[model samples]
Target: MGNCNSCPSKGNCNSDSGCSGLVPKYGKIKHIIGIISGKGGVGKSTVTGILAVQLRKLGYTVGVLDGDITGPSIPRFFGINDKRSDISQVGDGGEVKFAPVETSMGIKVMSLNLLTEEEEAPVIWRGPVITGVLKQMYSDTEWGELDYLLIDMPPGTGDIALTIMQEVPLEGMVIVSTPQEMVSMIVKKVVIMAKKMNVNIVGVVENMSYVICGKCGEKIRVFSKKTAEEQAEYLGLPLLAEMPINLDLVESMENGNVEDYVSKSEEYEVLLDNFKNKIGI
Candidate 1:
C-alpha cells in the first residue's frame, strides 16, 4: 500500500480533488424486494434474515422493514432489540432531520416493536391506520440509499398487504413456502395478491423441505415434493431454493444468530448469485 499519512479520509469520506472530505458516495440505489409468504409459520422471517445477511456479506447495502405489524419477528430473528429512538439534528436552513434506530450491520430499520414497550402487545389498528404508519415509515425514515429493502411481510395477503401495495413503491416480491400442501396453498394467496398489485415476481423459496438425520446420514422429506418446483414452472419463474432442515440453524436462530449458518453455506452462494443475475444487480 502507498503512504497514507496525509490521506484525507479516515476511511469514511470522499477524496475528490478541490472538494472537502465527505462520506464516500456509493451512487443511486435501485431496487426494493419484499420477502413475502402466502401464510404464516413457514419460517419466512428466518429466510429473510438469511437473505439479508447473505446480501450484506456480498457487499450490498441492505435494509429491512418489518411490515408484519401483527407479529414483527425480524428484530428478534437478528437478535436486535435496541429501541429505536428518534434522532433529530438541525440541518441547513434550521431544518431538523430525524434518523431511525439502525441495526448493528448499519441497516436502517423500523418496526411497530420499536414504538411499543413489549413484544407481546397487540396492534389492532384499522386498515387505514396501518397503511398510514407504513407510508410514514417510508417518507419519514431517512433510509438514505440501499441496494435492497427486504420486507418481511405479514402472514397473509390481507388488508395490510393491500395497503402497502397501494402505498410503498416496490421493485418486486419474493415468495416463501414450505413443502406441505396446506402451507403452499396458503402462500398462493399472496401470489394472487402480488399479481393483482402488478408487482414483479422475483421467485419462490421453499423452507424446511427436508431434514438430514443426525446419526443416520439419511434425508427425510417430511413435507411434500414437487410443490415449489411445480409452482415455479407453472409461474414461468425460477425456484430460488429449498433450505434443508438443519438443526444447527435452528439453534443459531434461537440464539439470535442465523449468520452462523448463512455466511458459510454453499446454498446461500447459489441462491444469492441467482438473485443478483435475475434482478440485474
Candidate 2:
C-alpha cells in the first residue's frame, strides 16, 4: 500500500494506498488553480472566467474545469452552446474518452452544462455521485497542453470541495469573498480547510467591495466597509485584488461574455497584472 509519501500522484492523493480516483494526465498542464468561495454569489465563477481570458491574453494556453457540477456556469459564461462532450475510443476494446469543449477565444472547457440536454436541469445528485463526476471529468476529459487549468469550484466546505482538495493536483487556491463580516468569517473557514488539506493558499480576492457612483465617481461601499486587507489578514494570505461592482461587468455576466467584459474594463486590466504577479504567470 502506497502512503502519501510513496504515492506517485503529484496532486492531492487523499488515499493512503494510492488514490484510485487519480485522473490520468493526457496533456501537459503547467499549473492547476482552484477558485473557491465560502458561500455562493460571491463571483467565484466570474473570477474564474476573468482569469482564464486574462491568461489567454498574456499568451498562455489556458483551460477551465467547471467543478461546480450542480450549478455549472462556465459554459454559459463562455457562451458555448454545445450540448455534447466529444468522445474518442481507446484500445481494441473500445474504451471511451471525453474531449473538453473549446470556447470562441480558444479556451478549453468541460462542464456538466455541456453534458446535460437542459442547461437549467437540476443536478439532483448526492455527494458521492457528484464527486465521482468531478473525478471522471479530471481523468476522462482531454485538456491538451494547457499552461493553466483553473478549476471553478463550488462554494463552501462541502463534499465536492473536499473531494477536489483531496484529489486534484492544485498548484494553489484563490479565495473569493465580499467585504462583509459574515463573508469574511466564511472565507476563513475555506482558508483553514485549504491549510488542513496541504493546499497552498495563493491569495484572496474581494469581490463587490464597493461601487463607483456614476455622477460623483466616488467609491461607495455597498456591501461593507471591511477591506481586503482585513480579509487577507484574517486568512494570513496576501490580498490579490479588490473588485468593485460595475454595471458593465454585470451586463457581461448576464450576457455570458465575461472575456469581452474584462478586456474593456480598466479595473480588470490592472487586476490582470496583480494576478500575474501574485501567481507568477
lDDT of each: 0.69, 0.81
Residues forming the 10-long window of minimal summed lDDT in candidate 1: 19-28
CA RMSD per model (angstroms): 9.1, 3.6
Best by lDDT: 2
For residues 163-276, could you state the per-residue lDDT of candidate 1 as single tens digits? 656644566778888877777677777887888888777888888878888899787888775655775665455798877877787787678566656787786676787777
- Residue clash pairs of candidate 2: 11-169
Q: Tell me how candidate 1 scores on lDDT.
A: 0.69
Q: Which stretches of model 1 miss by more than 4 angstroms?
A: 1-29, 87-98, 225-228, 234-236
Per-candidate TM-score against the hidden true structure: 0.80, 0.88
